[model samples]
Target: MKNPLILLALAATLSATAADAAEVPLYETGPAEDSSFVRFVNGGQQPLEIVATGSNARLTLDTAKPASDFLPIRAGKPIEGALVRGGAKRNVSVTVQPGEFASVVGLDDAAGGLRTVVVHEQPDDFNALKASVAFYNLDAQCASAALLAAGRNIVLLDQVPEGQSKRRQINPVPLSVQLSCAGQAVGQPLDLGTLEAGQRYTVFLVPAGKQSRIFQATDTVAR
Candidate 1:
């Protein structure tokens, strides 16, 4: 739950009664770089992610440049606090609700080209990515990324079916599964020989590596 330092310009807040005027910061969402509210994907599990719907998902800030290029916000519970950066009394406010916009306080060109737009630093919780490695068991079956080295593998599944004369005898149940590990085939499937009665062969999964081998399900017996 890191705080967003660039969004909240710590503007001195005096009661409206004490001051005749209070300035509310302002900005636009027109520029390609400043497409209004910056969009982000919550790759990690964050509660705030529940609200960001479309291209408007954002964490407002006072930095002059896109927060992704400078600093970024991590996905988490909605942040209401602010950060003080570059000698500015900054106070940042944010919400998941869409259609409304907030002005980045410290980013006024009058002082200088403080390229601040309404974006916070990238949130550690989310990523601009689509997929990640998922785990599975690879007993004599195909191993997935979970078992594949460097996220890939050259797994082989070879079987020796009985001759047609024996194939016509009993059932078509598989006796055992085999696996080729490294450069060697570690084991072989038990020979079902001639299928006997209602006997069924059960299969089990063994790990090739902690994160090796992807598991794929098959219904060959039914086939």
Candidate 2:
């Protein structure tokens, strides 16, 4: 009869190989221009090694890390990209139109792997006296929410759906921001002393201990 120990060892080797395939990195390449920008966000449970190929850029991001600012890259046609982790590799394909603002996010897949999506940001006329902000709903548990500017009747965003982002313009003044869901407040309002005019910001809502929370980052937009 075949040795049981040998069979067990073979099974272990095959299992390890399957695991590696499940975590392989994704890669791709595309044309791009300087008028465009690329922002990165990590929403997956496992950390990742972010590599922007054909552009010479890389970043290491952990779970729920704040969105990266619009990063400038040398305009290149057929630019390559890759997301690597656990010694596995996968190729990513991306294309940015001229004057386009975009963000790429890493998310968790249903199978405990990684899923990536590219978000095209909307552009608006600059308000020299106000600041613009964008909100992205990435929390799997938070279906929707609203953004209220303190003392203002403005609803910056209403029913922002999950896995998407919304933008609004706010006055460059001291104010607090609050979030509400299902007709009730989730947490304390954030006191933003004042926002700088002509600057852009992006906020991400993430899961935190049975509740959803937020983190903000500045974005560099070309005039």
Candidate 3:
């Protein structure tokens, strides 16, 4: 009952809509990133739409308006007692194949409250991982830096250009590294309780009596 010209036009519109739907967005399979807003990181290969509520969130590649569509579950928000936004959840995700996994991070008002959380929904392989909240001061300047031990790895995260000190730091402490050496440490770790605005300390990762072991400082941030 439609005119020929109108029928052709309708077909083209439908085709374009379908193409847009097929082109997955960059949100999928990328580490969680937030310019100023907090969002969940999506880990699936296909881009997903995020649904967030007061205390619940989920990600799916289904692209359906509602949950009753054909979206596969890639990740999920924490329940009541997990390690994220105070065991809540964070916005950090990476693109993951069906059997692979990735993590996301959440930032707080204070650098001392930054936490990282890993999400796995019906994971194909490994389970989820979570690290306690590690605090950093943006106001302090980095002096010298070093690794904790022979086998431990340290992650010096990006700086917080917009913090109280106008400079912030995020770093990781590997548990595998022993916390001390012959009464001296490679550093004095960030001790939040005793620190002022521009003070700095180091944490020493003493070797476990292993000699001739070389230490590798991969991602260390020094000011």
**Model-by-model lDDT, in order?**
0.23, 0.57, 0.24
Better of 1 and 2 by lDDT: 2
| Worst 10 contiguous positions by lDDT, candidate 3 | 2-11
Can you write out model 3's per-residue Cα lDDT over 1-223, one digit (the tens) per residue?
A: 2111100111121011211223222122322322111123222112333333233333332212211111222323221212233333443333333432222323232343434333322121111122222112211122222223324344332232212111122233333332222323433343323222222222211111222111111111111
TM-score per prediction, in order, is 0.18, 0.66, 0.20
What shift in Å separates residue 56 of candidate 1 from its native position after superposition?
Answer: 27
lDDT score, candidate 3, position 10:
10
Model 3 gets an lDDT of: 0.24
> At residue 134, what lDDT does model 2 achieve?
80
- Expressed as tens digits, the lDDT of each residue in 8-63 for candidate 2 is 11112101111111211111012233455565666554677666544434566674
Error of 2 at 109 (Å): 4.1
